[model samples]
Target: MRRLLLLPAIALITTLTLIAPTHAADQPNFLVFVGDDMTWTDAGCFGNSEVRTPHIDQLAREGMRLTACFTPAPMCSPTRQALYTGLFPVRNGAHPNHSRIHEGLRTMPHYLGDLGYRVALTGKRHFGPNESYPFEFLGKNKNPDFDAIGKFVRDAGSAPWCLMVCSNQPHTPWNRGDAEAYPPQSLTLPPYMVDTPATRKGLSQYYAEITYMDGELGRCLDILDESGQRDRTCVVFLSEQGSSFPHCKWTLYDTGIKAAGVVVWPGVVEPGTTSDALISYVDLLPTMIEAAGSTPSDEFDGRSFLKVLDGSQQQHRETIFAVQTTRGIIKGSEAYGIRCVRDGRYKYILNLNAENEFSNTVSQDGNIFASWKRKARNDPEAAELVESYVRRPEVEFYDLESDPFELNNLAADPTPAQKDRMAELRSRLNAWMAQQGDDGAATEMQALERMSPRSADGYRRWRAQQRRSGADSAD
Candidate 1:
């Protein structure tokens, strides 16, 4: 809750004079590499030995690795919206994948374009619900060829450019029998779930995807090296959300919301400087704008961390926030919506509606805890816990420091003196929601839970745009 307003000149001075060699007019080319559905502990730098993310790990070794970075939402579309607009997903009305970003808002790439930076994107541009508003130059796809990345950077013709490359490997539809590529025995399982052989096998597949994405990252980095822009370019590696997993990915757990972020710029970010400083996905836009000497819009809730790049700023946010969208089905129909928040140590989830009734009873792949349910039916303890979570409690709380796995709930437990802390946090969160004009967003989010991507307003908008395009062609 520290006020940036109190240190006005400090923020200005830090923004203006942080970078050394660059003149007031010189702008650095920007590049953001978004890894799809990646997690903090999955990367080599963060501590997963089995999952090979050598290139991303190398980027961390060469620059700064953020330990406590999180996206506003645990899912892809909402967090991507926040990243582009520097606002919370709820504030932008992009709470769920089916929801569209308000049309007139200036996006990060749009702002850069106005500043004379030729903007181009390659791979997953899942913005505006159905991803309707891709950059005019490049549309969304899986991964851009390494040779193409090099060609684009080299042929930028002395003008500054911004390129965003995204990938979608580590998501769902797990690779079943690739034991040689990713040995199941070598993988580690999170504590929230029982570490069975099946879990390990699933994890192995996710890691295989991680390894594949690492190769892609290496290709892009190699392209930058060959183009001779590696030194001058400011490279940022981040994720839209966490990997798709049970109680992760689409959920609001740390495994679902937190992402690995690393920034490398030879002389700018100090080597091997790891910071636990909190960073929101929303901050990317302002940071890019500030680094390039472009003005950020007043509506932006995020602040630039360019000082952190120049070794002048050590702290980012003291407390970070997070949210997730819920999914549901009603008599063959679908619904979706959600909103939540987290401080550094505790995560507070306020579900406006019950998960079972408000959304689908099954997971993304329609695996309604098939293995877990079988085990739970046999084990009384597991059955009790599963039943509790399934009932869709109004509030959930966890002590991240002690229960990093987030299996134990302190919201209803009186043994931990949690009620007082919970009340204080609830007050703070409610006040924040009100200030953002989202007093009933939690309730509205419940309505969204039952909505599907096909039924979303965003899809309608996309269809209308397509119709207009068709009409213009006819003319």
Candidate 2:
């Protein structure tokens, strides 16, 4: 693996001074836009002709498009925590969904705060312990408040600022856009998705929500332009995780963990460029810290990718790892703990509790999942896809170059070379787990026990109702 290059003290001082010669005391401001449950290929820039995302596409046309960005977890909270703390899920104590970070763990706000930057979050409070984050709470609304955000930016007169604008679009119960505009019949479903009326309808709604999110992004950009911060601020747009669909959200597949990333800094990053850097969400904090002219802490699980942003380096990470623990989700979802490691070509997954069938909120209540189940009764291929999703062996491997969607599992019958590669990846994953103090099942069980009894029982009833409504049936 290539290590991040660090400059000497004198060279670092010179670089910082040169980057901000006009306003030596003022560091560059950061404006980050995060989307919820959005896939890497959902926007127009990523080749999704069905979804209309003119604003996000414009960012790609005028900024740096990162092709291989991924999150540390498929779920929202875990991924957000990893991005905030630059720590993996286990180490950060937020491996499970709807979980909090370990006490006394510092976040991006603390790191940027020390560098004379005012860090504030405008949407989605999915993280906790007020002291650990301490972000100036700008407000929590799923939709972007352009006027308020503009006011906030304009108010940050001199001191550097880092503003996080999070959007809750394209998530579950997707009902925020003009669904009629995206006709179900005209949709192009992925190979992993079944073709049915319900599936198409669900996809159309999800695409519509994506378009809505894009419009929101446009609004934010307009606000920045109005505030005269477009040229001075480093704008970063991130698609947090994949959409809430089968084989997408809550899974370690490419559709689940992969994220779309774009960075626009007028004087720093070259416009209309694309980078194939293998960056994970865990690297965002460190990169932003370095971009703010501050040295990143050595305790971070990730390193600064400023070199990649500045076009001085091409590769960022040789491998990225992801984790999933369903203990804090609906009750009886304890069986869905998984860990995965992926490089440029291959991906290896280890389903920790593979003896039990995998079941989560998506599989139980998602419209696409319900549609898949309905289609499986008559379509053999759909039935096979459904079976593959619910039941899995202990280990699975995929040659991502050939099977980008991870449809084919190569672990069952591997050639000699494949076996060697699998062993190497397995060893790497084991070492990472040990270093993170990941006890897998034991940890998940403990998390489950920590949940309130009432909440657990409520979730159990909710899941039971879903099962009774034929949501879990393949007939």
Candidate 3:
């Protein structure tokens, strides 16, 4: 396993100087395609043979592929807030799902708009508080509108633009594509997943949705080509967080926080290159700021990785952190809180409230969970997986190189060196929590208090109504 060396502040300043700006007329436009609830290895380029993602694979072949990219949060709104603000979810005040950011914190629009760039967001506006992210809203639709996006790009005239196209695909109550195309019997399942009829069927639907998203990506790239901006544009495709399944979406495991990232900036990046630099979604805002020829703010928790993009740096950060809080979930769900720290090869997790059995939206009402339980009745391995999904220990550690699925907990049987490493990771996580003003139990209590008593009841009623109407209620 390769380890990352932490750069000194003075060295970072010097590296920033190496990123020169393009010509005034040739400033690169940024087009970011964010896939909701998609896991790290679902695309064709990421080694999934079952899912067909020709467009994303093509982008990898034409651009730079990041082998390891993680998000600050596994859920939707929290991750989006962190990505736009360059701050962790705890500091941004959107640590819980479906939550808003802090009142006065600025977003990418505020930072990039000051540099004479137009930032616009189309489709899925999961973020809130119009003032925090005052981007020009092009439109909102689950599906892509290539014609309108092309028009938006062309109308920008000579000014550079940053457009975020958020796609609501591969999310649950999956049903958006032709599920018949992906046969459940022929699909390959991950080690963390149980082999059952319902699990296979659910995974096939999810794969179909990923393929649909790929087609939409192809359409967006076509729009860029037709508009003649493909050469001067930086295209980024991000697989946001993980899918909504057991041991994936809501957990702080690698499967939950790790994301797939690909970037294609014509003149700045080499074609068909792969980078093993460690990066987080919070670093994206600062990178784009530097790419647009502007100085990044000192207040951001993330530093720019433009040097990595320019082929001048092999490493970015020595460690990355992730957080999760299940307070605002539906009624009867346990308030599970998790904090994690990971270096290149090892991961350490602290389950803040591990006394209570964990339960969330994903584990309760999905056919996938139903199938897992059904299989658990006859299979001991499936029973263990199901039990581990809900009953977690106070602390867990894993050497990711040896156990990528993180099934084996090494907290109890660490060697002397592993014990020291675990202590170091714990110290780092504690210091980060202090910096973010994260008082674990108190924070969870506050989030719980903020949730109205009627909110959970309302959510239950909404789910019932959706079931009656045959609508998707998997948010």
Candidate 4:
């Protein structure tokens, strides 16, 4: 009887061990720290001397750092829309900020939830208005409060949780007078912008905001560690687009598209590993799905770079694309706008209407109209930056290797070799745009057609009303 009892006990112990969850520990929690209106070199991990982001730097030290990452669009709404839908901004009628993301889109979090991962988002979740257009992926609502994020995670009642945290800071109305903390002279203004006291003064506030953002992220990371989820969590930190600088925010240049990307997955991704893989906003969704051990559907335009995380592949993209939209700047003026294709060495811009009324003037200044106009007059560097705003030839090219600042335009050169490279990039752009269903100025046409007489008249009436209201209020 004793032997028989012992035999059943042994069998029970074996069964319990075998039935334990295999992915309980292996499946990593997901946390994405998205900064609003940040530039490419804003983080300490990305080699910025003025910025002090110790927590973000620590994340890079604990995981893989991705260089050469670009956003699909320069603007926030379209870029975030494309990143979530895994489609180009044009496909969903989100060419610019005014257009909302279409309803019933299959987003990353929407699909991940089906795979047993709990998903949540907090802070600056710019997924367009939910009343007009809803996303299948977002849980609860868009832009959930920061305090609510932790509560949602705890209530998930699951082992692995995915949280998307976006912070809005360092964009505009910058914290002035804070430039004193950073060496004002050491601020490396982009070659396109002038080195002036005002520029440095603006940067000082921007840096302070970045530092403040860093503190917020540090708090979240500390919470994760305290909850014993550090080892089982994968953290990705990046920005939506560039800062509020002239010629960068709304343009396809490095200032607008290129961003600092850092990922941390302890024990899985090797720490201190840096890869120059040309990553884009499109790659984020597919990569996150893969990390969750789930396969994305064929609908996605991006591919998973699991090899890069494992240190097997060195680079991902050889070339990247950029789009610009200026439909609202001028009324009844519809232009197909500028489309650019950039490799590591060169950038080719196709101004669909170079000679017509829809000409692409020095297309770099995408900031607020007030700030942009001021910079052009007061800042000498602004003049050089907006040089392309002038009427251009059908095509323009810049050799980024030698002229990283993009001061010289070589399209006018009579050299045969330069002409050949220009032709090649043009062909590539045309082909890619055609494939994406974004040939020429179709975006501009959509914008014009959609803008009704009522909307236009409403804007005009609102402006006049505002003036009258201001006068009356002052009295």
TM-score of each: 0.83, 0.91, 0.90, 0.81
lDDT of 3 at 364: 67
Query: Please, what are the lDDT tens digits per residue for candidate 2 over residues 328-444?
Result: 576346456899999999999999878766787667666677888988999999998998888888999999988999999999999899999999999999888877777777766
Give stretches of model 2 more than 4 Å off.
1-26, 449-475
Question: Please, what are the lDDT tens digits per residue for candidate 3 over residues 316-398?
Answer: 99999999887676532345788999999999999888886677766767778888898999999999999999888899999
User: Candidate 1, 40: how far from true, in Å?
Assistant: 2.0
Point out the higher-scoring one by lDDT: 1 or 3: 3
Where is model 4 more than 4 Å wrong at Cα? 1-26, 129-146, 176-180, 183-186, 329-336, 353-382, 389-394, 448-475
- Give lDDT: candidate 4, residue 174: 67
lDDT score of model 4?
A: 0.66
Q: C-alpha displacement of 82 in model 1, angstroms?
A: 1.0
Each model's lDDT:
0.67, 0.81, 0.82, 0.66
All candidates in order of lDDT, best leading: 3, 2, 1, 4
- For residue 229, model 1's alpha carbon misses the true position, in angstroms, by 0.4
Q: Tell me the TM-score of model 1.
A: 0.83
How many clashes show up in model 2? 0
The TM-score-based order of candidates, best leading, equals 2, 3, 1, 4
Top lDDT prediction, candidate number = 3
lDDT of 1 by residue, 1-475 (tens): 1233223212321333222225423778877888888776888898877777889989998999988888888767778878877877666667666456654565665567667677777877666633334454444356565556777888986778888887776766655224477777766666655455666666777788778777778888888887777778888888568775566666677877888989998778998888777788888888888777765644566878778777787888766666555532211112234456667777777765454333233331244355666678778765754565445577888889998767777777745467777777788777766655564544353435324555555544643564566631221
